[model samples]
Target: MSNHKDEVEFPKMSFLLMAVTTGFVGGILWSLIGYLCYYFNYSTIEPNILLEPFTVGTWRESWIGIILTIILYGIISIGVALVYYILLKKLNTMWVGIGYGFVLFLVVFLILNPIFPSMKPFLQNDINTLIAAACVYILYGLFIGYSISYEHNEIKYFKEKELKR
Candidate 1:
């Protein structure tokens, strides 16, 4: 007979919290990197330009624009993390994350290009800009995907190991 307490199920919050935190970190960090790359002339994509569609038509070079973009990315990433948790949490592989990042990059650069007036279409972007932005997205995806996957798998692994002992 199994212990009643052990058999009983409870709502888990840590994973959800981790997903939120990781998503926020990934968004904030990656967006900052992207913005910096743009600032340094390493990438053509920039946050203020991307967000111009949402804001009044004015070029904001102040710290406020940068902070707003970073925060907005973090918030968006929280939703993205939830999506990953719901759909892709079971796949504990690094490639999945990398692909996820690449997909996001494509979505923004190609599919979402028309939505933002400031964003150049995929064809208009040179190879270097694409590479730099793609790399940032890839790393962000890795940060979010691998983190959630590892946490999920690590929990299951330890449980299985304990059961076998």
Candidate 2:
């Protein structure tokens, strides 16, 4: 009986920890990817143009950009968690998580690009930025979806075990 209770509690705790860790790690990874893109000029017109518009003139702008990227990544991570929660509530599978991630990326991209017209010139008109954004978002979605799905599955498995007892 004690063993059963321990087993039941362990998974709940593990699931919660996994979810939090995954979100943090995914956020960091996404931010790192964004910084790399900016540094490599993947998102700029010229190889070093990411710093051109910012007046501090040095790579100090890159630091500011990194901070902003981290914030954006955190937002993306939270969005992924919410989407995963909704899908779990619906009794859907991991595939739904991925689908939601992709849909969210597209919807956000479309809505935001219009609001920030400056981004439109870089991403919409420029091929490099467009490709970089697409690739980064795809990787971000995949990682977040996979991590959440893994956590969700662990929770479901524990629930099933509890039911069997």
Candidate 1 weakest ten by summed lDDT: 52-61
Q: Write the residue-wise lDDT of candidate 2 on 85-126 in tens digits.
A: 555534345565556556655765676445443455434557
lDDT of model number 1? 0.85
Candidate 1 off by > 4 Å: 1-13, 57-59, 162-165
Clash pairs, candidate 2, are none
The most accurate candidate by lDDT is 1
Candidate 2 Cα outliers beyond 4 Å, as residue runs: 1-21, 45-65, 88-97, 121-123
Count clashing residue pairs in model 1.
0
On residues 1-165, what C-alpha lDDT tens digit does candidate 1 reach at each position?
Answer: 888678977776687898899999988988889888898988877776757777774445578877888898999999988888888998999999999988988988878888888677898888889889899989988888999999999888988999998
Models, CA RMSD each: 4.9, 5.2
Residue pairs in clash, model 1 = none
